[model samples]
Target: MDYIDRAEATRRILAAKERAGLSFEELAQVVGAHEVWVASALLGQNTMSSEQAAAAGKALALDEATVAALSRDAARGSLPAAVPTDPLIYRFHEIVQVYGTTLKAVIEEKFGSGIMSAIDFSMDIDRVDDPRGDRVKVTLNGKFLPYRTW
Candidate 1:
Protein backbone atom coordinates (compact mmCIF):
# COMPACT_ATOMS: atom_id res chain seq x y z
CA MET A 1 0.00 0.00 0.00
CA ASP A 2 0.99 3.62 -0.53
CA TYR A 3 1.94 5.92 2.35
CA ILE A 4 -1.51 7.53 2.49
CA ASP A 5 -3.16 4.13 2.34
CA ARG A 6 -1.01 2.84 5.15
CA ALA A 7 -1.79 5.90 7.28
CA GLU A 8 -5.51 5.50 6.69
CA ALA A 9 -5.34 1.80 7.42
CA THR A 10 -3.57 2.52 10.70
CA ARG A 11 -6.33 4.99 11.60
CA ARG A 12 -8.98 2.37 10.82
CA ILE A 13 -7.17 -0.25 12.87
CA LEU A 14 -6.91 2.09 15.84
CA ALA A 15 -10.57 3.08 15.53
CA ALA A 16 -11.68 -0.51 15.29
CA LYS A 17 -9.55 -1.36 18.30
CA GLU A 18 -11.21 1.44 20.27
CA ARG A 19 -14.68 0.44 19.06
CA ALA A 20 -14.04 -3.16 20.12
CA GLY A 21 -12.75 -2.03 23.50
CA LEU A 22 -9.65 -4.15 23.26
CA SER A 23 -6.23 -3.40 24.68
CA PHE A 24 -3.06 -4.14 22.78
CA GLU A 25 -2.37 -6.86 25.35
CA GLU A 26 -5.75 -8.44 24.64
CA LEU A 27 -5.13 -8.18 20.92
CA ALA A 28 -1.68 -9.70 21.43
CA GLN A 29 -3.34 -12.67 23.11
CA VAL A 30 -5.61 -13.06 20.08
CA VAL A 31 -2.64 -12.70 17.69
CA GLY A 32 -0.39 -14.93 19.85
CA ALA A 33 2.46 -12.42 20.06
CA HIS A 34 4.00 -10.00 22.51
CA GLU A 35 1.97 -6.85 23.15
CA VAL A 36 4.78 -4.47 22.18
CA TRP A 37 5.49 -6.37 18.97
CA VAL A 38 1.81 -6.57 18.13
CA ALA A 39 1.41 -2.88 18.79
CA SER A 40 4.42 -2.08 16.62
CA ALA A 41 3.03 -4.24 13.83
CA LEU A 42 -0.35 -2.58 14.06
CA LEU A 43 1.26 0.86 13.96
CA GLY A 44 3.16 -0.05 10.77
CA GLN A 45 6.62 -0.25 12.34
CA ASN A 46 6.86 -3.99 11.79
CA THR A 47 5.25 -6.43 9.38
CA MET A 48 2.91 -9.11 10.64
CA SER A 49 2.68 -12.63 9.34
CA SER A 50 -0.43 -13.58 7.40
CA GLU A 51 -1.78 -15.59 10.33
CA GLN A 52 -1.13 -12.75 12.76
CA ALA A 53 -2.65 -10.24 10.36
CA ALA A 54 -5.73 -12.39 9.95
CA ALA A 55 -6.14 -12.84 13.68
CA ALA A 56 -5.77 -9.13 14.39
CA GLY A 57 -8.02 -8.22 11.51
CA LYS A 58 -10.67 -10.62 12.73
CA ALA A 59 -10.39 -9.32 16.27
CA LEU A 60 -10.49 -5.65 15.24
CA ALA A 61 -13.06 -6.09 12.45
CA LEU A 62 -10.60 -4.61 9.97
CA ASP A 63 -11.12 -4.54 6.21
CA GLU A 64 -9.16 -6.59 3.66
CA ALA A 65 -6.92 -3.69 2.68
CA THR A 66 -5.95 -2.90 6.24
CA VAL A 67 -5.31 -6.55 6.95
CA ALA A 68 -3.17 -6.78 3.84
CA ALA A 69 -1.32 -3.65 4.83
CA LEU A 70 -0.48 -5.20 8.19
CA SER A 71 1.31 -8.05 6.42
CA ARG A 72 3.22 -5.80 4.04
CA ASP A 73 6.81 -4.73 4.61
CA ALA A 74 6.71 -1.41 6.44
CA ALA A 75 8.75 1.69 5.82
CA ARG A 76 9.45 2.02 9.48
CA GLY A 77 10.21 5.14 11.60
CA SER A 78 7.88 7.51 9.78
CA LEU A 79 8.37 10.32 12.22
CA PRO A 80 7.63 13.85 11.01
CA ALA A 81 10.80 15.26 12.54
CA ALA A 82 14.16 14.06 13.83
CA VAL A 83 13.19 15.22 17.27
CA PRO A 84 9.74 14.12 18.26
CA THR A 85 7.39 16.89 19.42
CA ASP A 86 5.04 14.65 21.41
CA PRO A 87 5.82 14.90 25.08
CA LEU A 88 5.99 11.22 25.89
CA ILE A 89 7.90 10.33 22.73
CA TYR A 90 10.18 13.29 23.27
CA ARG A 91 11.03 12.03 26.73
CA PHE A 92 12.47 8.90 25.17
CA HIS A 93 14.44 10.98 22.68
CA GLU A 94 15.66 13.14 25.51
CA ILE A 95 16.74 10.07 27.43
CA VAL A 96 18.75 8.79 24.49
CA GLN A 97 20.29 12.18 24.01
CA VAL A 98 21.32 12.40 27.65
CA TYR A 99 22.38 8.82 28.18
CA GLY A 100 23.56 7.84 24.72
CA THR A 101 27.25 8.30 25.33
CA THR A 102 27.11 7.11 28.92
CA LEU A 103 25.31 3.96 27.89
CA LYS A 104 27.77 3.36 25.09
CA ALA A 105 30.74 3.79 27.40
CA VAL A 106 29.32 1.56 30.11
CA ILE A 107 28.20 -1.08 27.68
CA GLU A 108 31.56 -1.10 25.98
CA GLU A 109 33.32 -1.41 29.30
CA LYS A 110 31.33 -4.55 30.03
CA PHE A 111 30.89 -6.08 26.59
CA GLY A 112 33.87 -4.64 24.70
CA SER A 113 33.48 -2.61 21.50
CA GLY A 114 30.11 -3.48 20.06
CA ILE A 115 26.58 -2.38 19.58
CA MET A 116 23.20 -3.70 20.68
CA SER A 117 21.13 -5.34 17.98
CA ALA A 118 17.72 -3.79 17.44
CA ILE A 119 16.91 -6.63 15.03
CA ASP A 120 17.28 -9.10 17.87
CA PHE A 121 15.65 -7.15 20.64
CA SER A 122 12.74 -7.45 22.99
CA MET A 123 11.16 -4.85 25.25
CA ASP A 124 8.74 -4.87 28.13
CA ILE A 125 6.95 -2.04 29.88
CA ASP A 126 5.50 -2.31 33.36
CA ARG A 127 3.97 -0.16 36.06
CA VAL A 128 5.87 -0.21 39.31
CA ASP A 129 4.14 1.00 42.40
CA ASP A 130 6.02 3.39 44.64
CA PRO A 131 5.19 5.24 47.84
CA ARG A 132 5.68 8.59 46.17
CA GLY A 133 4.15 7.80 42.81
CA ASP A 134 3.77 5.05 40.28
CA ARG A 135 6.82 4.45 38.13
CA VAL A 136 7.13 3.38 34.55
CA LYS A 137 9.51 0.51 34.01
CA VAL A 138 10.75 -0.07 30.51
CA THR A 139 13.09 -2.96 29.80
CA LEU A 140 15.04 -3.19 26.61
CA ASN A 141 16.80 -6.46 25.83
CA GLY A 142 18.94 -6.77 22.76
CA LYS A 143 21.71 -9.06 21.63
CA PHE A 144 25.21 -7.61 21.91
CA LEU A 145 26.91 -7.61 18.57
CA PRO A 146 30.66 -7.18 18.84
CA TYR A 147 32.46 -5.40 16.08
CA ARG A 148 34.26 -7.85 13.81
CA THR A 149 37.91 -7.50 12.93
CA TRP A 150 38.56 -7.01 9.24
Candidate 2:
Protein backbone atom coordinates (compact mmCIF):
# COMPACT_ATOMS: atom_id res chain seq x y z
CA MET A 1 0.00 0.00 0.00
CA ASP A 2 1.26 3.46 -0.80
CA TYR A 3 2.14 5.36 2.36
CA ILE A 4 0.07 8.23 0.98
CA ASP A 5 -2.48 7.07 -1.48
CA ARG A 6 -4.61 10.10 -2.26
CA ALA A 7 -6.86 8.03 -4.46
CA GLU A 8 -8.18 5.77 -1.72
CA ALA A 9 -10.15 8.38 0.16
CA THR A 10 -11.40 9.98 -2.99
CA ARG A 11 -12.26 6.65 -4.43
CA ARG A 12 -14.03 5.49 -1.32
CA ILE A 13 -16.01 8.68 -1.07
CA LEU A 14 -17.02 8.47 -4.69
CA ALA A 15 -17.85 4.82 -4.35
CA ALA A 16 -19.80 5.38 -1.21
CA LYS A 17 -21.80 8.10 -2.87
CA GLU A 18 -22.44 5.97 -5.92
CA ARG A 19 -23.42 2.99 -3.82
CA ALA A 20 -25.81 5.21 -1.99
CA GLY A 21 -27.36 6.14 -5.35
CA LEU A 22 -26.28 9.73 -5.45
CA SER A 23 -24.49 11.73 -8.13
CA PHE A 24 -21.38 13.84 -7.81
CA GLU A 25 -23.19 17.13 -8.30
CA GLU A 26 -25.84 16.09 -5.87
CA LEU A 27 -23.34 15.29 -3.19
CA ALA A 28 -21.39 18.47 -3.77
CA GLN A 29 -24.49 20.62 -3.66
CA VAL A 30 -25.66 18.93 -0.50
CA VAL A 31 -22.25 19.43 1.07
CA GLY A 32 -22.14 23.12 0.00
CA ALA A 33 -18.92 22.77 -1.98
CA HIS A 34 -18.49 23.28 -5.66
CA GLU A 35 -19.02 20.28 -7.87
CA VAL A 36 -15.46 20.65 -9.10
CA TRP A 37 -14.10 20.24 -5.59
CA VAL A 38 -16.02 17.03 -5.16
CA ALA A 39 -14.82 15.77 -8.51
CA SER A 40 -11.22 16.60 -7.70
CA ALA A 41 -11.34 14.90 -4.31
CA LEU A 42 -13.01 11.90 -5.89
CA LEU A 43 -10.20 11.76 -8.41
CA GLY A 44 -7.56 11.93 -5.67
CA GLN A 45 -6.40 15.29 -6.97
CA ASN A 46 -7.44 17.22 -3.87
CA THR A 47 -7.79 16.97 -0.14
CA MET A 48 -10.95 17.47 1.84
CA SER A 49 -10.99 19.58 4.98
CA SER A 50 -12.68 18.49 8.18
CA GLU A 51 -15.40 21.07 7.66
CA GLN A 52 -16.01 19.80 4.18
CA ALA A 53 -15.97 16.17 5.30
CA ALA A 54 -18.40 16.88 8.11
CA ALA A 55 -20.77 18.51 5.67
CA ALA A 56 -20.25 15.67 3.25
CA GLY A 57 -21.21 13.21 5.95
CA LYS A 58 -24.54 14.90 6.30
CA ALA A 59 -25.05 14.95 2.56
CA LEU A 60 -24.15 11.29 2.19
CA ALA A 61 -25.96 10.11 5.29
CA LEU A 62 -22.73 8.74 6.73
CA ASP A 63 -21.61 8.71 10.31
CA GLU A 64 -19.24 11.46 11.39
CA ALA A 65 -16.69 8.84 12.41
CA THR A 66 -16.58 7.34 8.92
CA VAL A 67 -16.14 10.74 7.39
CA ALA A 68 -13.38 11.44 9.88
CA ALA A 69 -11.71 8.15 9.02
CA LEU A 70 -11.70 9.10 5.36
CA SER A 71 -10.18 12.46 6.14
CA ARG A 72 -7.52 10.83 8.34
CA ASP A 73 -6.71 8.26 5.66
CA ALA A 74 -6.40 10.94 3.06
CA ALA A 75 -3.96 12.87 5.21
CA ARG A 76 -1.80 9.77 5.72
CA GLY A 77 -1.63 8.73 2.07
CA SER A 78 -4.20 5.96 2.56
CA LEU A 79 -2.11 3.37 4.33
CA PRO A 80 -3.24 1.69 7.52
CA ALA A 81 -1.73 3.18 10.66
CA ALA A 82 0.14 1.12 13.23
CA VAL A 83 0.26 2.75 16.66
CA PRO A 84 0.53 6.29 15.20
CA THR A 85 4.27 6.66 15.60
CA ASP A 86 4.21 10.37 14.81
CA PRO A 87 4.77 12.52 17.88
CA LEU A 88 2.14 15.07 18.76
CA ILE A 89 3.52 18.57 18.56
CA TYR A 90 0.42 19.90 20.29
CA ARG A 91 -0.50 17.78 23.31
CA PHE A 92 -4.07 17.63 22.04
CA HIS A 93 -3.12 16.91 18.43
CA GLU A 94 -4.32 13.33 18.70
CA ILE A 95 -7.78 14.52 19.71
CA VAL A 96 -8.12 18.19 18.77
CA GLN A 97 -6.76 19.95 15.72
CA VAL A 98 -5.82 23.48 14.94
CA TYR A 99 -8.38 24.93 12.57
CA GLY A 100 -5.87 27.06 10.73
CA THR A 101 -7.98 29.59 8.85
CA THR A 102 -10.48 30.05 11.67
CA LEU A 103 -7.72 30.74 14.18
CA LYS A 104 -5.86 32.96 11.73
CA ALA A 105 -8.93 35.04 11.05
CA VAL A 106 -9.63 35.51 14.74
CA ILE A 107 -6.02 36.37 15.48
CA GLU A 108 -5.75 38.85 12.65
CA GLU A 109 -9.01 40.49 13.58
CA LYS A 110 -8.24 40.67 17.29
CA PHE A 111 -4.49 41.38 17.61
CA GLY A 112 -3.81 42.60 14.04
CA SER A 113 -0.37 41.05 14.21
CA GLY A 114 1.18 37.67 13.45
CA ILE A 115 0.09 34.34 14.83
CA MET A 116 -0.26 33.36 18.46
CA SER A 117 3.10 32.57 19.97
CA ALA A 118 2.91 28.87 20.64
CA ILE A 119 5.88 29.29 22.96
CA ASP A 120 4.18 32.08 24.94
CA PHE A 121 0.60 30.84 24.85
CA SER A 122 -1.58 29.48 27.59
CA MET A 123 -4.73 27.39 27.35
CA ASP A 124 -7.46 26.82 29.89
CA ILE A 125 -10.36 24.42 29.53
CA ASP A 126 -13.26 24.28 31.92
CA ARG A 127 -16.84 23.18 32.04
CA VAL A 128 -19.62 25.72 32.09
CA ASP A 129 -23.23 25.17 32.92
CA ASP A 130 -25.83 26.16 30.38
CA PRO A 131 -29.56 25.82 30.41
CA ARG A 132 -29.48 23.61 27.34
CA GLY A 133 -26.46 21.52 28.21
CA ASP A 134 -22.98 21.63 29.69
CA ARG A 135 -20.44 23.34 27.49
CA VAL A 136 -16.68 23.20 27.40
CA LYS A 137 -15.16 26.64 27.70
CA VAL A 138 -11.66 27.31 26.45
CA THR A 139 -9.60 30.44 26.67
CA LEU A 140 -6.26 31.16 25.04
CA ASN A 141 -3.90 34.04 25.66
CA GLY A 142 -0.60 34.80 24.02
CA LYS A 143 1.86 37.66 23.76
CA PHE A 144 1.57 39.59 20.55
CA LEU A 145 4.47 40.94 18.55
CA PRO A 146 4.08 42.71 15.22
CA TYR A 147 5.56 41.01 12.21
CA ARG A 148 9.07 42.18 11.47
CA THR A 149 9.83 43.80 8.14
CA TRP A 150 13.03 43.41 6.23
Q: Each model's TM-score, in the order given? A: 0.94, 0.38
lDDT of 2 at 103: 70
lDDT of 1 by residue, 49-142 (tens): 9999999999999878899989888767768767899999999999989999999999999999999998899999999999999999999999
Question: Any residue pairs clashing in model 1, and if so which?
Answer: none
Tell how far residue 10 is off in model 2, in angstroms: 2.8
lDDT accuracy of residue 146 in candidate 2: 67
Per-candidate local distance difference test? 0.91, 0.62
lDDT of 2 by residue, 1-150 (tens): 233344445556666787789877787787676665565555554557887778776777655445664455333232244434456433334443456677777878987868667446555556899999998776766788668788
Model 1, CA-based lDDT: 0.91
What RMSD value applies to candidate 1? 1.9
After superposition, which runs of candidate 1 have C-alpha atoms over 4 Å from their true positions? 1-4
Relative to the true structure, candidate 1 reaches a TM of 0.94
